[model samples]
Target: MEDPAQRRVDYGDRSFDEADLAACPLEQFQRWYSAAVDSGEPEPNAMTLATAGPDGPSARTVLLKGVDARGFVLYTNQRSRKARAIAHEPRVALLLVWHGTHRQVAVRGRAEVLPRAETEAYFASRPYGSRIGAWASEQSEPIASAAGLHEREAQLRRRFPDTGSPGDVPAPPHWGGYLVRAVEVEFWQGRTSRLHDRLVLLSRDGSPAALDDGAAWRLERRQP
Candidate 1:
């Protein structure tokens, strides 16, 4: 097997400076996120979520459904491996890569399970087919075959004949959202000769306002 890293591709394109970044890390993240979407990147909300478990760390790509001052929010089946990992270790890390734009955001923080009401609201708002699929599939669980999945889907379809009605779809107890309260946020911008710009913001007591007046977060530049 070839080591992909050995195949070097020079990243001598763009440069970033501390003076050009947003005062708050979240703002900078938004700027990059918007660019990612505008650039036609597939699934711009997709991010690699890393969680620690007994064996080691596990990572999976999950869609970022929400983000705000509270942090980044993603949903998953409660019985999934990632959810179990979160139960054991509340801390989590998220890596968002926009290769088209040569930008990345690394976030580390604590994850909290959102309340049932919030989960239900989000669940009800999903597309009808997605809601049905959520009910039909036992995520991260072993299945007999592809036919089994189709059979399960058939059964769900019969149970909930009307797809458009929210009444036909109930939020699965195993499905919910987890909010990552970021304590550390790093923004990386690729530059020429690998002299990339790396700016980090560290939160004080999980508060975004702490970065205000230079008291909330300490900003630093790292050598690329």
Candidate 2:
């Protein structure tokens, strides 16, 4: 049975047209993404990342740190549950919804750990506190209490004293980023009636491409 607290409603924001869509999924994604950000949607870059473990599927909200023709990139603790799952099964799914704009994007792709150089570059850009936090968190592991967690963070702080040293904290061995190269991407937009618009772009050679190579993608519209 459905939960009593669950709610359902029809979308009625705007219509979408295939004629107006970009030939490449990356370009189309950029167009909608820019609009979402410019329109001041809350957490415009937030996305739900889903992975499959031995037991079942798990999902969590993650921030989208970078995106380009190659695919979408996000950082996380390499020891986190999601990372563990991805280690066994590299395929993952991502979803992003913009409530105010009544739009959402879904991505199906395979994930690969970013190169050490890329991870280090991003880690270096992090604020001091965030860099320390990465080292302190044993993500998805049990902790005795909040105090215990704080203690570990304090220990990291002392070891890596933010002495304003030119010595930037290095990216921990257990921390890094992943690039999800999309096999398929779908975009949905709300319409006046219950019949909304759904468009999908699929890769031909099953390889990631940059913005300029977007022409290799095939486009199609799906019935809502």
Candidate 3:
């Protein structure tokens, strides 16, 4: 087996300072996100969501579907482990890694389920097959076989055949979205010798606030 420790690459020296940051983390994130996209980074919106419940801490990668002053948004089956964990404990964390840009963002926040209207709206925008799959698969549940899953999906497709209209299939009741209201947001930029630059924005009151509320936030530089 190859020795994983033998592999190494120096992260080019890049500095991200307060002077380069936007007044708000969301805006800064948007700037970085745009840069990442322009650099041809694949799946730039992919983020790791971490949740804690009675059992323990759990983390999974979920695609960021929306973002704005409200916070980062993602969709999933409400009955899934992550959803259940959120139900047990709304406090959660998120990590967005953009390897191509040698940058990452970390967020500590609370997850709130988006309203049904918003969830349905986003669900309707998904691919036709994805809508059917949402109905066919019971997220987080054990399945007998891959064939069985495919068969269930096939059955759903027949029941709700695509009619060239997105409304042909509706989002399942268990499927919805969550908004992560970030109280603390940290932006990291890799640098040479692991002396990374870390800048964090924290809510003045230690509570979640809109990303545009610059007056209610404080920015701090942290040791890498």
TM-score per candidate, chains pooled: 0.91, 0.92, 0.98
**Which tens-of-lDDT digit does each residue in 65-178 have in candidate 2?**
999878999999998999999998999999999977888899999999999999998988888999999998899999989999899999998889887643557889989999
Each model's lDDT comes to: 0.85, 0.87, 0.93
Model 1: pairs clashing at backbone N, Cα or C within 3 Å: 12-192, 210-216, 211-216
Lowest lDDT sum, 10 consecutive residues, model 3, at 6-15
Instruction: Give candidate 1 misplaced runs (Cα > 4 Å).
Output: 1-6, 205-215
Question: Which lDDT value does model 2 have at 129?
Answer: 94
Best by TM-score: 3
lDDT of 3 by residue, 1-224 (tens): 98999977787978898899898877899999999999899899999999997889999999999899999999999999999999999999999999889999999999999999999999889999999989988989999999999999999999999998989999999999999999999999999888999999999999999998788789889998
In candidate 1 the C-alpha lDDT for residue 13 amounts to: 67
Residue-pair clashes per prediction, in order, are 3, 0, 0
Q: Order of candidates by lDDT, top first?
A: 3, 2, 1
Q: Which stretches of candidate 3 lie over 4 Å from their true place?
A: none
TM-score ranking, high to low: 3, 2, 1
